[model samples]
Target: MLRDRLLQMLPEDDAAAESVEGLALTVTDLAPGDLGSWLADRAGQELGLDVAGRALQGGGDAWAVAIADESGTSVALDLATIDDADLEALGAWLADPAAPIAVHDAKTASHALHGRGLTLAGVAVDTLLAAYLCHPDQRTYDLGDLTVRYLQRELPTGVDAESDGMLDLGLDGDHSGARTAAARAVAVRELAEPLRTDLASRGATALMAQVELPVLATLVGMERAGIAADVAYVEGLAGEFDAAVERAALGAYEAIGHEVNLGSPKQLQEVLFVELDMPKTRRTKTGWTTDADALADLFARTEHPFLGNLLAHREAIRLRQTVEGLLKSVAPDGRIHTTFQQTVAATGRLSSTDPNLQNIPIRTAEGYRIREGFVVGEGYEGLLTADYSQIEMRIMAHLSRDEGLIDAFRSGEDLHRYVGSRVFHVEPAEVTSAMRAKIKAMSYGLAYGLSAFGLSKQLGISAGEAKGLMDDYFDRFGGVRDYLTGVVDEARGEGWTSTILGRRRYLPDLTSDNRQRREMAERMALNAPIQGSAADVVKVAMIGVTGELERRGLASRLLLQVHDELVLEVAPGEREEVTDLVRTQMGAAAALEVPLDVSVGFGRSWRDAGH
Candidate 1:
């Protein structure tokens, strides 16, 4: 059909007229009439145009007339402008079930024709989408890469626009229809296998077909459904934070001999470790430890006015900085749309970028003040915060099937007290405050690659004493010890580890040449299963919660996910219902040996949401 159309456009006087691989014709280009005649004359001579539909579609430009032969490639003419009737005709041809049309520069064409209410002749097949389905994590998406890998040759560029912004093919007497047809044929034929292989390899062909691809149709819908933000509330918080920073700076300057850089960890380390001579606890690459825990430890040992004041100063400054960053990052519509990075963490945990929602302040009293900045907008009643309670521990219990651990959660007992009582060889009621405190530290530390030496540094105790405490802990919870060791050993053998959801993370560096790299990889191997599994559970929960909200036609929107917590922006009257929905959906996302528990709270401000 394409060949017939090209042949019909040619001059009747053309001699030695023969179709070479379909549409390419050879006729003397002695004279020309209009654009159409010129194209027809060129088509007969240099333009080895392919009559085959596949060949025509491969050029990536719908209106381009390509000329190619066995020697090499060239373009005869490219139509920069075409009327509606011509476009419609092209579309009609492409829409035929048996006919295929190829177009390059679809993105630009879409934009250019948008104002005229015009669209391409046929539906554009996204090569980028095909490539992504093949390798979801590959970083680049160049057409050149696709062309080389699939077609095994380079396509012509700089044809649509010249340096002088005029239509010029730079023909160089090499333009032929055969070359054009060959290039197009190659692209169309080569694409199918890569697309199929990619879809199969990532286990994402179904996900793409069933979920991700379809969901993109809803992306514009969601953008249009942007959540409201309290502009006044945000601005008020920024003003308050600015005031707090000034006060904290004053306090810090008075505590130290003179004013110093409060934000500089190097300066703080010098003042705390060298000047104060506050028990050289641990050595960092820079010299002495200046981490948050180290600072807290230093404060405890000295009980010095300056150390306490400096710690307070650090907390206040950090809170102020976080608030300031948030204020700066708010979008024009007043809401903060933090970007979720799905693959940054090896364990398949999503990280927040742009404005990091994950690291929002929570623990310290000063940090808690920053929460007050996040308030309900005008049509919204308040914010609802829902968090999983001791989720990681519950997961550990389930995975390890430790009877004592499972019993601890099942009996509705305080986990730290249960652990403390077991470790201290005492009744739960008799577990001292001091014992519970130590157990709390150990519980969290264990998940973070803490060793006896690390624990000793954290607890300000002798390494031997720390080792004894750890041994007692393991003795009281033998299953946990066995589970941790078993996971590490299993991961070491497999060269990778996976979460409960089958999200695999390779750790080839576990056998690295560098000791530090290997040791770090070992920690990751031990930690990935626990952390990653928890991450997977939360992701499934978020997706489920989002779906349920949509199904119920609720007004509440999931605004942010901070590690283990979900922050929801609720409609004025839907707080109670929304809170229940969030807790229920999140808790039911997954089940392990131990039950999932969730805690819910609401407030006009983030601070009020916390108990």
Candidate 2:
């Protein structure tokens, strides 16, 4: 209205009015290179305002720029839609070092702009990152949502903005776009302090500043330098798995004396109980259980060939599915670019999707073969797989302050073997294989709130025997048993559990009257702090390793993080330094009663690296 009214005050041939530009800038997404550098220089100064193409879209998805300091906002342009000359003009204005650029999430936008050859410098704060610090649990930290959430102000957005108490400009129109962008840029700048202050209030400033932010930079590099996949090898593995699937299917049919769908539960039920007249294992909602565990139990009792074939069939088909999934997700560059979802898991663990590199099986021989397909890329020397050895156990020992458990780790003997000896009343060197296996299972399982009954089922032993083993084990390591029980009790009393780093997981159901609900929450409460602390330690280690690599100017790239492991692609001649750095950084991620032990392996393929 102001511009139109002023235009009406001038004569039709008024020279000044004729040349004046209406929202004199084209709005576009932030792209890297010369234009990106230009925009980076202009962040945070009063500028001619128009549209904020980047701000309106979302920081991680786009870029923001200031026109002229009419309050550090201008017409934002989508680099995609704007004419070349208009873009160049916008670039020229942004080249001024005085203009300020604000982004929503530096992980997405900064890394993207870096890919385009423009590294963001100067006054920049990712408000999305700010919102994360404020409320780490909220997954989507979009601009419009955060503005309304933090500032009680809604930016102009959505398909129909006129319906809400927002700027009533059409979403597609330049005027509306400019309003949305301006509102967001201002919000990004304005929202930072309140969020930061909130972080300070919660005592989360160090977690955000020292841990998450630096780790995010590492994650960006990992996401971009995705692990290379051997396409031909993957295809060949799929073929082998296909043949195995067929053979397993044929064997099941022959063993049953007739063809049946091994994948179908109903068909398996008919063949197992009705046709073969086998004894029932367990009852389910539909019928007698033909589930994997139940079938395995039945096979153990009767040595049923059909059951064995069925299990084999299931395993083969699963391998094929994994291979097919990988083949489908392979990008044009021959790498599997798994998107690491940083904020998905409540325990602060990272999740991988679009091939889910984390879930790739590693227990079976075929699984090891599947890993062989993860090979080094052209520019990297080889892959390095480094992992913390029994990190969670060390954390358990530290948190429990259990003398015997600490001795087991500090003694430098085989941990499980030594533990088995104590429970079996034998010397560490005299621990039998079976005793060590059960001890190992109990050692890891107890930390996760595993009960005697559950452990019995897992080990295929009588529940009474399992109970005796647990009782004996706890007698030897009484501190661990006491600590496990105390964690649940504390959570029930306080309504939450805190990790060693002070991250909290609130377990509201710990106070519930319902026994089932209460028990589940108890297990979670008991498990959360230990697991969450390990997660914190790994994240800190990631940041340290990444920062040190950059500081030392090494060419090796951290590719994937699989729970307790870090997979790096080493460059030529940097393997020794990189390996030592990873071990040191990971080991120093946290201070525990016992040492943080790390195991490092490297080879041409992920399989070899594991060895």
Candidate 3:
């Protein structure tokens, strides 16, 4: 075991000599005693650690530790071969919050450790998150990329070192995995200084410490305690959706007066454009597009039954696929564990993947049934969902400080109805539903930087009408228009827009030479603060709610976070308590011009829990 572990941890002497020719570090395999010695040497100092694990959320297979001291040494420990005593000691050291350490993707590392019956703590810096804070515009924050970008060095590979002082350890297949892991640990160690410095310089240190890191831990808990699934229910829903797909497909074929592959875009195009003699939609390289929007537009113009049936077929197919995905994702423990991605969305919103519960439809009756597939487990009484109503609009009111918008919320009237009355020049009680709908659309659209033409397309109105409506809205709420313009202007000058919590989103393209790119960046700038602030508030609420759950000794646990909503599984007797706790914590998560209205519901399944 020792020999095998050594072979995994260190390269052969000749290979090491040739591989690290220009490198300044020594490589060593950590024997049992070396663990203590290296840790003792680095006590009261910052270090970097990485774990090679079975799965991202599974047990660790090996571990590496690198210190940034002048010694320039990194030690590798194979978890599989390490003595039981050493492993326990390692776990203790890991859980010690006093021991400062940095790692890439600390949540994954924490999950990996958790699978081994260990806990990970003391992660003072998650380089992945720090890099995200530094460069949120980037698509990825891979360790290799971070190492090259921040540390000005490439991670070691099996290839030999370049003569020009770049570090490379000529790792062979026998030891490449372990040696590479060690190299990443070293890179993470070296990255700490520049990354932390960048974060501090950006005034994002508190955002990282107070919001991101704690949310990381909270997410780890939520992912581990995945929501329970009704496997039988999901399987049944899949069948129903499949039937619906077939029925819609048949209906489409009958309407077209012939059978065609509903799944084929070419066939769809032939039927709609050539056979049915419908107007040509947007032209694509392959042909005219048969996408949902184009088809919907065609249907609106001609009221073609074929197009309607085609749209229904597409919807059924989508629902069926989602249900099938849910069925496949059911774990052996009879639950679906979704990975909440923190770094994906630039606005800091948490996204669900691996059978995304967040994407489950809510508005349509068929879509709502899919939520019924997620049920409370045997030990729980039911599911309780609490969500903030009109969170983004509320955020917009707070940020813009528009007196009309602010007063609209404070008046305890329907926001859209009140705004509609003002925009259409009617008394509040006399506002028509149609007028309120337009007001609601315009209000939310402004936050998204929606243009008049885009609003016209969405609401089936003329461009002139849409523009006039927007003019009226701005007239009534000039403060909002001014705030939006100022947000873009300030971002243009400063190269970044800031959230309520001082989280900056850099938009260098605000000064771009290209009109398209600059305008797009302007839209992003306008939306970032409102959307990002909502995300920040939700995160703060998650942290507070999770903390209070423990503080108050509640058995109900948070199952998932879907945008502005939180789903929790209530203990047999704890539904009322959990509801109160969630409402209080979530409503008080952030202070704004308007009260954060929380709607709570309880049900046996997720669908019924909707408020």
**lDDT string, candidate 2, 219-262, tens digits:** 76887788899999999999999999999989888887789877
Could you tell me the TM-score of candidate 2?
0.82
Ranking by TM-score: 3, 2, 1
Q: Weakest 10 consecutive residues, lDDT, candidate 3?
A: 161-170
**What does candidate 3's lDDT look like per residue over 1-611, in tens digits?**
33344444444564642342122222333445555555666788887876544333232443332333323445545555556666676677788998888887788778767766678777889999999998988979988799789877676655332222122222233444444555667777778889999999999999999999999999998888888889888888888888988898888888877899989999888888888888888889999999999988898899988888889999999999988998888777788889999998988788999868789888888888889988998888999998989999999899999999999999989999999999999999999888888888888999999999999988999999999999999999999999999999999999899999888888999999999999999999999999999999999999999999999998888889998999998998887788889999999999999999999999999988886
lDDT of 2 at 383: 95
Residue 389 CA displacement from its true place in model 1, Å: 0.9
Off by over 4 Å in 3: 1-12, 16-37, 56-70, 159-174, 283-286, 300-304
Error of 2 at 41 (Å): 10
Query: Which pairs clash in the backbone of model 3?
Result: none
> lDDT of each prediction vs. the true structure?
0.60, 0.73, 0.80
Stretches off by above 4 angstroms in model 1 are 1-244, 247-260, 265-282, 289-312
For model 1, residues 490-516, the per-residue Cα lDDT tens digits are: 877987776776555667887889999
Score every model by TM-score: 0.67, 0.82, 0.91
Highest TM-score: which candidate? 3
Candidate 2 global lDDT: 0.73
